[model samples]
Target: MCSIWRTLQRGTLRDIALVCLAVGVIGLSYGAVAVAGGLPLWVPVLLGLLVAAASSEFLFVGVIAAGGSPIAAVLAGLLVNARHLPFGLALPDVLGHGRRRILGTHLMNDETVVFALAQPDLPRKRAAYWLCGLGILACWPVGALLGGLAGTVIEDTDALGLDAMFPAVILALVLPALRDGETRSAALAGSALALATAPFLPVGLPVLLGLSGLVLAVGRKRETEVIR
Candidate 1:
């Protein structure tokens, strides 16, 4: 308990709890959506447990629902999940050793990685990582199950006023990192590029283009160097 409290001193526990809750709600909505779209109750629940990736699962569902190719949906999801490679690399210490490490990597997600990175030290990072990761792992699928069962009655989740919370949780997690000028510029440029291209491109491509914003931030570094 002392260790847990000490870890929370970096102001992680509350945010972790909120993030878990937000993802849980989103998962519930996903379940509701899947069932309403004619998917069996088991499908979303299974995906939630095995896939454990909200973005990828949603894209897959959207594609499949639209009668698009499953191969394309899977490929898109794989592309989205590729971002996890760096996430795994950046979080070696937090992952622990052996069996724990396997579970840790399995539990990894944007929320877990972000919360871990937000911490000031190793112990706190580990605490944040596990807390957020485990919490989401538990919540997301359960929410999906409940949502699937309820989906027959409530097909749409937008009415629940939850559309904003997911993005808000993400923004809250990332806002601190944006304090760095280069990161801030990169984020802005990425968001701008993503938004600008969204209409012209496909659903996931804009997000990939947004990563190119890091290149734009390089320009700022050059300007700063010349000023010095």
Candidate 2:
């Protein structure tokens, strides 16, 4: 309890709050779309609370809207979220142990991970992670609920440009990582592969194919180290 309070006091509250606001807006867009696509309002609200993965939730809702089978939608969502496997492996210290760890892992989304890692020390990292996670968890569902209700009145979100916000936010998050050479290489390679495969492959599969860029980049680094 004291630890949580201390964590919150570490001066990241404002940043976390801002991120939560952005997430809430995005959640609103998602909920509105889901409702517009004929899903029950409860479905988007539940998915926001439970899934909490923006990209996967969007993909799942899109597949369902397109008349895809539930099994296929589930599989596609899983594939889209598989990037989190590396995120989990990379943040063992932040995750900690026992009961809290379960919640910690569940909260391991892109925003949390990015914010946590940007911190200088372990304490700050954990603090950033928890703050961002909890903030998003709270705001996302509430926004979804409100948006689902509003969907009945507003027929089109695209006119409001909500649809463009998701990718814009993602690009903003990814841009900072490009300052690192290896990350830049990996990102460029992955993006190229994804773009190349976009027309030929199914939606989720291109992302999986893009992951090979990470593998290839790491392998090259290992080979270089061996030569040294």
Model 1 lDDT tens row, 36-146: 767788988999988899989888888788888889989978876776876787889999899989888889888888888888889888988888888899999999999
Q: What is the alpha-carbon lDDT of model 2 when measured against the actual structure? A: 0.83
- On lDDT, the leading prediction is 1
Question: TM-score, each model?
Answer: 0.86, 0.82
Per-model lDDT: 0.83, 0.83
Model 1 — TM-score against the truth?
Answer: 0.86
Provide the RMSD of all predictions against the true structure, rounded to 1 decimal: 2.5, 2.9
Q: Pairing residues by index, what is the TM-score of model 2?
A: 0.82
The clash count for each model shown is: 0, 0
The parts of candidate 1 lying over 4 Å away from their true place are 1-6
Q: Once superposed on the true structure, which residue ranges of model 2 sit more than 4 Å away at CA?
A: 1-12, 152-177, 219-228
Q: Write the per-residue lDDT of candidate 2 for residues 1-228, one digit (tens) a residue.
A: 457557655446776777798889877778888998899999989998888988888899999999999898888888878878878988999987999999999898888988787776898889888878988999998988888888855556678786776567557666777899999898789889988998987666777678888988998899999999
Best by TM-score: 1
